[model samples]
Target: MTNHSHPSTTTTHSFKDLISMRQAVQSLFLAISLFMGIMFYLFVAQLESGAMPTLERPPGVEAFLPISALISLKYFLFTGVFNTVHPSALVIFLIVCTTALVVRKGFCSWVCPIGLMSDGLAKIHSWLFKRPVHLPTWVDLPLRAIKYTIAGFFVWSVFFKMPLAAVEQFIQSPYNTFADIKMLDFFTNISTTSLCVISVLIILSIIVKNFWCRYLCPYGALLGVISFFSLGKIKRDKNNCIKCGKCETMCPGRISIMENETINSLECSACLRCVDVCPAPNAIGFSLVSGKVPMDQRKIALVIIAAFLTGITTAKATGHWQNGTRIQAYQEHVLQDRMSSQPPMKIPANTDPEKMKRMIERMRQKKN
Candidate 1:
């Protein structure tokens, strides 16, 4: 990431760096996101076709519905009921927030699909320019506030403005219940305005290092604030004594690593690229409080994945992972919007014969 060019020795990566391992983890999660998108599309297709979905809806798709997650989070706090309408949304939100507390926005570098895309855009930025185009402190500092302002607006509106009753009502509202399908439709049937906006963001990301994450993402802004209290951080060993500017030039956060023993900037995503590029051994690492125990990209990736798996597994065990929206409700909502002619609601495929018989008879009785 350092823009300064030097005649350098080829660096051989050791287990201590493990940058590839971190990427593999990102790719794994990214692939999982794609799979969930496909499954959810098929599940919705079955519903619209008036057939039973042999494949269950992937609740992991709820990860994209963060506002619903925020509302559900407040509802759970107020009522102590983990509402079923968008249960997985709340579960995913809590899991991600927990990672910021433990590892300082590792979720951005290690898990989020956007983060992976951001990294690619950064490389493109490097290729397009001879040296990194950095904004001056006077301008950069003010721009950073934009995301915080955006995140603050949401926090204030949802957490402070909405009352307990309003929170409960939103969770049960038809909009919240059917949000996942609406999300699918948004992408599958994208409008011109949305497409143009997305293209602009991608282009900006390519021009500037992680433009969305650095200056515009509300989630990244919130995580950055939480990262101030993170348990692990980049710790530098000054006594090891190579004051090379490589680490600073390589830093995506644009932080000055040599000035301090610990890197406390909210912009640090725990990507560990600094550690990977450093020539001096034992000079810097992601270490815990005493600045002795090292956490490589591999170890942190495991911790991030473990945190997600544990949270999701516990949610499933408690019967709060899958949503409770009835299949009939989904049929009615999807077809109402998508189809012109109504088809007879059919028994879901691959169900017990007796159950299908009763459901068909029940539909017949309702029609008559």
Candidate 2:
């Protein structure tokens, strides 16, 4: 038997350093998201205050409108036209899905703000429990299916149940166009029920590592399903058979790395925790193909970043990154009482005067 005790000389950085690098990447994305949120709040506040927004609305804020994006996606597929109502929402959605196909749901691990929160809660869990809490396989297996079921329901509703015309109508609806603002209100003006639900989730996260990601996040479920076809995967070496179980212990996905030569599990986020914990040389690593040498963690990180940046750059160049919704429309929507039974028609601010006049007339007719 080959002695796999010697650490592979593939990368000079230690496992701890690799983990630090990942955390740093996660922090950078989280900071960007926070900045976007602040900018959006200022933009909305200006609108509500009846002042011209000094700061332009950050199109990146539309990333929160995933349901709108899904509707836009279906409409696009059916009509061969991209919806400008929230183009960035669809653009961000596509970027996320593309990353999953290329990097195995790395978005959940490296980019999502929610993932960062979950990681922080997991640390609290570790401090509280000392040893990691492991749910029994019987219970765990069924719970893991919940996210998939949720994802499936959305996909089916949008793709199978709704007709093409309905999809287009939904994409063009006032609700879809203003979903980002609604999402912001959801957090800024959270109700008691929402607060209680969030509190419970936070508590559960402290007790169970990645409770939301493992069982509830429909977005993660969609990505996980797409990641089944990811080019890269965690591969284990059986020949260098020193299975000390460190890899399994460290895996957030709770996957048994030693049991399989190739990890094709949907739950595997390709977070590299298993690779970081493996002590034996060439015993476990991420590979683009079966039986190939594993790529360095630094290289994998670069690839993931490059993929996202490239997608964003392409979207920007193609004029699909920003919605055409004008500042005026947002201002009107903000100032008006949206809770009224008859909300005003949401026309994009950039529409021609004649078109706007006709649309307003049609809305008036419908109301009367």
Candidate 3:
């Protein structure tokens, strides 16, 4: 590979500017998520108190229900119909998956609230340690596989083990209908076991950069697997590289970008830290195609935003964004004092079996 010896040139903007832009994007999504959480809590509180909810339920909160979304996705594929219980869950899921296919786990870096929290913890890790700790390959490799194994188990259970009828049945079950409320309670009324697990993960993250994201988030593993087929990637110009190793040092995923002309590693989160830190001009950047011109951080930000907005907008226009489940369903489910236990895999109380049957028949007719 050819090498350059010239001094690093100044670009239009500094790496800090790029990082600030990413932070801005992350902050926006985190704010939205928090707002949704607050709104949903109020809505549920009203329902539990035997009062009509004045605050409309925020459908965006459904984004947290990834397992329900996966099952909904399979149900849609098998029956050619969207599950109305948590339609936005599947929509957000698709949007995230699309980002992975186009931008290589950009959702993890740009959109996820957990990612924002992880980034914050990573900064703390940097402050605590003079040099970041990296586990040995033997330990790291197995730890990384933990996420894939978790993802695999879910995919296998939902897509392989569950038959089409069972998928439909589960979608209509009380568990799926009230999953969002259960998720809220999981945090609001945090259990001892859950608290311990979260505390341990937080402590580990403070010591190791991106500890949970890199080794535990099955959702991230799913995105990483899909990103292998993404058209966009971080490309390294071997000719202009100075072999300074700054890129690898700054990589959150611990990917060795200096060793590869193109970073095809599943761990690459498209965070652009490497690109921002590169001293050599045009040495490393995000590119749509291999050996092509690199895209600016601003443009990548716009693309991620646009992809999300486009997917949500399309789903809304097609009447697939908001769920069909009535607010009364939530109120009734909550008022029955049923929030304390896991919902049974049966038709929810206060739901009309005839109405559900008609709805399923309508879906089949539409398919035919």
TM-score of each: 0.87, 0.88, 0.88
lDDT of each: 0.84, 0.82, 0.85
Give the per-residue Cα lDDT of candidate 1 at 104: 91
Candidate 3: global Cα-lDDT? 0.85
TM-score of predicted structure 1: 0.87
- For candidate 1, lDDT tens digit of each residue in 53-163? 898999999999999999888888877889999899999999999999878989898999999999889989999999998778898888889999999999899999999
RMSD values for the candidates in order, in angstroms, are 8.1, 7.4, 8.7
Candidate 3 segments exceeding 4 Å error = 1-10, 338-368
- How many residue pairs clash (N, CA or C atoms closer than 3 angstroms) in each of the candidate models, in the order given? 3, 0, 0
The TM-score of candidate 3 is 0.88
Tens-place lDDT per residue, model 3, 1-368, is 22221112234668788779888999999999999999999989998887778888898999999999999999888889987899999999998898888789988888888899998998898889998988889999999999999999999999999899888888889998999998998989999999999999999999888999999999999999999999788777778889999988988898988888778999988888888788888677777755343466677788889987998899889999888888888877886655456576687799998999999899879845
Question: Which should have the higher TM-score, number 1 or number 3?
Answer: 3
Query: What residue pairs clash in candidate 1, if any at all?
Result: 2-249, 2-250, 52-348
Name the candidate, 1 or 2, with the larger lDDT value.
1
Query: Which candidate ranks first by lDDT, i.e. highest?
Result: 3
Query: lDDT (0-100) at residue 115 of candidate 1?
Result: 93
Which clashing pairs does model 2 show?
none
